[model samples]
Target: MSRREKDQLHLARINFLNLIGQSNPSDAWKLFCLVTPNITEEQVDDQAETSSKLTLTTIPPDVVEMIVRTIDIESEKNVRLTAKYLKQIVDARDTMINRVHIHLCSQTVGIEVHEVTKEEPETYSFNVSVIPGVNHIDNAVKKFEEIISKPNTKINHLKIDWVRSEENRASYDELLKSLAVSLADFVEKVHVEELTIDVNAVEHLENLICSLKPDILKRLYVIGPPTCGNDKFDFSNIVILPQWKHLSAFTSSCCELICPIHHLYHISNLRIKMASTSPIDIVGYRDTLIVSQQRIDHEITISHDMENTKQMLEPYIDCSRLTTCRGYYIRSNEKRLTFELKHNKIIFSTMQFLM
Candidate 1:
């Protein structure tokens, strides 16, 4: 074959291989040799480089993401790390890399792990140790404060897992108090879109939520049971800031869900799972009330019977000021009701009232 003809064949093979590699790397490797007949290893490498450059230039960014996502993270981490074009594809999309997970093993050993599946073998893990003879609570609080102060990092989600620690239970309360203070302070400055806290320490959870200013927290999820103390737990003291839009609670105690809805009027989305079957009262603006209630294994029943439960909701519904509801039934034979109101009319009425 002529030199020009051979070059054209090589380019074709290169483009074909690249397409397959992006779509299915394992399959691409299996068929690599058949398409590039008599091509040496060095020639194949050069062709791949040429094809990568061409792909980067010609393909739309979103299309490149589809190709990058096809590769398994654990198996192809090295390949992704080495290829500039592939790395760009992974970074452009908000895949797994943007999140950080912190697991508290014990007072002595704590593990912070960050995994991004889009990047090849680019896993980052940091281990934080408590100062010897010093308080682990202090160390955790310090680290948390540092994370909150950094403005450039987009840490919208935080997960705290407290691994069972027999040795650390003695000082758990002090540690929890410190952690709660830090969390409460953090929420004030940072836009915490989602928070997941798993600790045996219930006091910390209460303190953290109570201390939080609530203007910056858009969503909250507390995982654990409520604490029993000398004083009765007053759900009213727990303030639900106007900024809170989504609230979720997983507690062994059924009563914890009642306070947030009864006092906090701004939540638009709410999910709560409790140990027992108890009647729930939901109150909110007609435009922003979306509630779902379910039992452990039994059916979930959602009521649009806002008027039946609370008289205040009647005026909001009658005037057409508040109007949107969506409920989902999970597991049990339950009824769900949803409503949507016209906001334009509500706005006009409010303006007229002001005049």
Candidate 2:
């Protein structure tokens, strides 16, 4: 026997004696015999006679069930393929799945799991991509249906991303609707995270959000270029259900924000695009809303309010751009600065109270 094999045999024998001592005495003695090379032919014959009938059911109930759940699902699958010990690990209970990624780029729908317990939480930018590939649509969808429909699983995070092109948008929307329908059927009430989707139609997006378990969604981001010949989805029909206890961020392409100030301001962050020359109605109302837009508000100045004024700038940053109390145009290529908003304008300054 190889050194590794001998070591494993020794370890198994110890585990057999420790946990399976009294109840599984038969297994205990057989393991002891494997570790002891000097065992008699009588014992070998007895083991041979009984080994064929020994089933995994003979193991203790708890020992038979080993819950191995994680964000690194691929690694678990690979290990299970090689080790019987791992194959015996069940996917059902005692598992805490912090993030669930449904990778759509590959031909096969990839279900990746990373093992994280309740005490530690992990984060990821939820994205869904459907690049042209050798993907079999019907088979892939079926596989995804099977994975998401797995019983006895509590998914805390879920997202699928889809890229948009004028030619593929309508088709893409249909696929997204189908996927959302499937998810709603399986996914129950749970906390949601960053979901990057292409929302070509408002009704589809609204229906998908409504399907999710209410009140626990933390963040849902709608990203991608505008669809329908640069026309934006009218956000008039969008309604915030009472169940969305934690729904905050909702940013979509060219989508307008209108009534329901309570829910509107509840959105602490949003990214908007400048579609027209007319000024957007975002300047007056202030409710701790952080707005990010493609157009830099020339009227707004960024103020630096750090305790130490000079600490705001990096060592390599040009000091010429720094001002005592004036708003400067921010170019992302130059340097990133800490900023706050005052009077509906972005403010950045050093050695002065900004707001």
Candidate 3:
């Protein structure tokens, strides 16, 4: 035999012996006779029948169920592949999935599902290759449904990443559209808690966010590619969605938001991008926080000139109170709102009190 084969056989023999020692002692001698190479043909024939009875399928159902319950999702999937009875046992149980991430590439769609247990978190990856050969979109959707559509599966977070390249641009867009449609169909069933998407197309992002069940989704994040001057994205439709209106936390990174700033005032935690923040916008933000009873924290990253923005807000700077080099405060009654301008970021915080 080859060196690798011999090493593997040696390891297997040691493992079988150790397992036999820990378990029932009566089967040890029988298994020992089966493993020993020097045993005669007649001896092998005698133990063949006994060894057949030791197959994994012969394990008691309750014991098999207990074993499958303790393993991670991937291990449970492997156990199901080993035998039909094991598959049945695993399918009967429900598993808690912590996160599901879908990555859309030019030639392939990748899926990552995570399961958290007492020991550690377990991750499972599934990739559907669309490299110009097979049924592209249909095959990908089929594989996606197979993995995420498991009965009684609960997912806490869902993230879709669109990483399209210039080479296969057309195919990538089609795949993304198909997947987004498929995702919209099952938004209610998954009960996704937090959704973070990196989409290049504004329409797709709006559609995806609007499709989410409003009552179930609480956190939303939109991460777009970096943009230059005068290139702003329209999120007018997104702000109107019930899902967006009810979001407890919202984050928009790298892309300049063109809509009115008032649409974001209700979110408890907000991180958004604006091409420019006018003096009127700043005053409105401060006024909203002052009379509000709810807690609020906001971080606005500006793409315009920092000096110009500071000069514009100079008139409204509450100079009567103590002011630092780059820090400005806007206070009303007992509530004090602070605005800190550092490089391209504008941070705003409010001290809220009960009436």
lDDT values, one for every candidate: 0.44, 0.43, 0.60
lDDT tens per residue, model 3, 1-355: 5666544544333333332443556665565444444445464344443432222333333544354344344332322222344345444644456777876666566667775422454333434545666665567666666656775555678887766456645665666677678877874545567988876677777766665667778898888767734433677677787777778898988777766778888888889887553222755665676566566778787654556656655654443323432444545455455566667676666643211
| Global fold similarity of model 1 (TM-score) | 0.43
Where is model 1 more than 4 Å wrong at Cα? 1-97, 107-109, 113-133, 164-167, 182-188, 199-203, 206-216, 226-233, 242-260, 264-268, 273-355
lDDT rank order: 3, 1, 2
Which candidate would rank higher by TM-score, 2 or 3? 3
TM-score (all chains, Cα) for each model: 0.43, 0.44, 0.59
Question: For candidate 2, what is the total of clashing residue pairs?
Answer: 21
Report the CA-based lDDT of candidate 2 relative to the real structure: 0.43
**Root-mean-square deviation per candidate:** 13.8, 14.9, 14.0
Model 3 TM-score, all chains together: 0.59
